[model samples]
Target: MTAASLEGAALTSSPALGVIALGLPAAVLLLAVIWARPGAGAAVRAAASLAVLGAGFALTALALRPAGPSAGPPITPTATLPPATCSPDGGLLRVAASGFAFDPDCLAAHAGEPFRIAFVNEDAGVQHNVAVYEDAAGTRARFVGDPVTGPGTTIYRVGALDAGTYLFRCDLHPQQMRGVLVVA
Candidate 1:
């Protein structure tokens, strides 16, 4: 993944938000305890500090614990198209990924057409995903496939789009893998 993507995901994740919530109050309480002196009440001040520290620790633990495997929205695995050398109409358009480069290097497909993109993750110790963008403009908003993880397969129905060229690539390994889709 790109540095920006990794940072974005980290920032948006729940644990990061929890850290912020836990930190702000702990900091405020610590400052207040240090500055507000109860004259000749050293024991009471120490007790209050300990209580604040314990509460902060508890909050941190609660934030870090996973919500279990089935916590959020269910991810229904997308259908996997069988390995094939050519398109349904006998046109060759399959891209194979091994060693970071997508075989076939490029492809073409009609708009509103159902085509199959076979993504194979051949590199050991490597994880990958393919994202099919609607047009050549690689904006985040218009995309068909939601980055299919590799060492796997996924079938992408080429959604209808204006007559133009579209692009596809591994979001995790962009420069090493890329392909095109021609929508007539």
Candidate 2:
């Protein structure tokens, strides 16, 4: 099955299955404690309580773990290309991504230029997306493409933009995969 389909299945599976899986062991331990010899019952109950406590601690640790930094290359701007001319169809920008970095990290275009960006993800098993924002901090998003797993491609069509320095990055690896879109 495709990776996307598998992820969807995992998300849509019945919650009852998870509940049953978690509760079955506790229930078994409870039954064991109840059926044990009179003096041994207390020890069994204590062991069961410790097991439940350990499980709870493990679940909490998994839920509260902090997401680490991106494993991709560092965010460094390379040379800025000259402004691209808009053709009769539209201006075209090609971006290739692999190992958490985009080729041609800095791009240039004329103001009010209608453009289509062809974003290609070449890294296997990595999910990436292209998003454009009005600011470098990415607080004001202008365009966000659907997340695509490698090897895959997504085309993002952007309307005419005013002269400014826009920010573009992979939403999944924003820290490592980012670039500047300079409109002159």
Which candidate tops lDDT? 2
lDDT of 2 by residue, 1-184 (tens): 3555444343323443454466557656765666574766667768766777676556534433333333456555433422433223337788888878888676666678778888899988788988888876777898898988899998888878888888888888876787778777
Cand. 2 TM to true fold: 0.57
What lDDT does candidate 1 reach at residue 63? 55
Show model 2 residue runs off by greater than 4 Å. 1-90
Q: Estimate the overall C-alpha local distance difference test score of candidate 1.
A: 0.56
- Assess candidate 2 and give its lDDT: 0.70
lDDT of 1 by residue, 1-184 (tens): 3555444344556676767675867667785966597573777777777777777767655555544422223433222221323223323346667766677655665555555565566655556666766534445424545554446666554544555555666666554455665555
After TM-score superposition, the amount by which residue 68's alpha carbon in candidate 2 deviates from its true location, in angstroms, is 12
Which residue pairs show collisions in model 1? Answer: none
Global lDDT of each candidate? 0.56, 0.70
Query: If scored against the real structure, what TM-score would every candidate get?
Result: 0.43, 0.57
